[model samples]
Target: MINSNSRSVAALVALLVATAMPAFAQPPASPAVPAAAVTSDAGVSGTAGSSRDAARARRKANRQLVKRVAAVLARTRGLDSSRILIRAADGTVTLSGTVPDNMQIPLAVNAAQQVAGVTVLRNQLRIGMRME
Candidate 1:
């Protein structure tokens, strides 16, 4: 002889309790991962050493090319070798510093281009005022 509203409330509470009971219960334990299945660090040193050696060889070749470009520029006519700064990387030569006249700029570039290993030439020379 309960009121219908009260009956509905009681049924709702029972349903909620039944649904939440499993959520509060402890779950079954899972097996641990096997050690053999875990990933390992391999070939770490060999890969690093090979890259280092390749970089070293590249730098050595760049240094030799720089020397060759500088020597050629020093021997070019109408250019002051002492006033020019030369730097090379990966077969590219960079010429910087001030020269006595604007004509020396092209002269320097031409000399660097004549070198066997030069792939690019960068001219950064400035023409200084004539000395009396």
Candidate 2:
């Protein structure tokens, strides 16, 4: 006659073998994904490419804003823009570097502010002689 402990051991072994059998079995073959559905780069999808393009476009727009502001300052009478440096991001513009005349500082700021697409203006200009 089979003892209770021996029967319990036999049942536990059978349960373990039943559960572990699936781990050794080969998995079912999966359908291949179409080439058009796959992205150029591994682990990256189409959204990453679109976002990269968007970031590039934003940088280009910022550069264009800086050029327009610099042009405006250059065309402004009594304002010397040669010594000034302009930086733009989004709609914000930063005016840095030194101006020969104190009056030209306001002229630069005002002219930059009047230009379209300039939402914020940061004036880092100082009154000093132009270096070199």
Candidate 3:
């Protein structure tokens, strides 16, 4: 007893209602993440990132201080790069090697000490001694 146009309209309405029902009935939910998993992920990045950054900065600063101290020693009176050896451990400077004369020992020590990051200077310069 239904008209052809009426039947088509009813079919379209049914299709529309079927599609709209699911969307209106529920909103999309975020995937459920466990608290432990979230915390572990964050903790890994937290400590590692900060410590890595600090270590990089420290290494860079140490290299710069080494360069500056080496430059000073190279230009110092009676002191040459060959006669000077410098090792820096966490800002403590250790100077080794031989100079032309005994008095050059103090000059080498003073040169290393004046560097900005040099906290300790261990001078092991033995004048008139040669290393082969």
Residue-level error in angstroms, candidate 2, position 85 = 0.4
lDDT of each residue in 1-132, candidate 1, tens digit only: 569989988987785575446435624322344555344447556655675687679778888987888888888877886767776777877776668887888888888899998898878667554333
lDDT of 1 at 34: 57
Q: RMSD, each candidate, Å? A: 30.3, 27.8, 32.2
Location of the lowest summed lDDT over 10 successive residues in candidate 3: 26-35
Q: Specify the highest-lDDT model's number.
A: 2
- Superior candidate under TM-score, 1 versus 2: 2
Candidate 2 clash pair list? none
**Number of clashing residue pairs in every model?**
0, 0, 0
Candidate 3's residue-wise lDDT over 1-132, tens digit each? 569889988987785576445445542222333454334476577766676687678767777877888999988877655756666667867676557677788888888898888988877555544434
Model 3 residue 117 distance off true place after TM-score fit, in angstroms? 2.1
Count of clashing pairs, candidate 3: 0
lDDT of 2 by residue, 12-109 (tens): 77855754464356243223445665467756767667766877898899899999998999999998899788878789888877788889999999
Off by over 4 Å in 1: 1-42, 129-132
Query: Which residue window of length 10 is worst by lDDT in model 1?
Result: 26-35
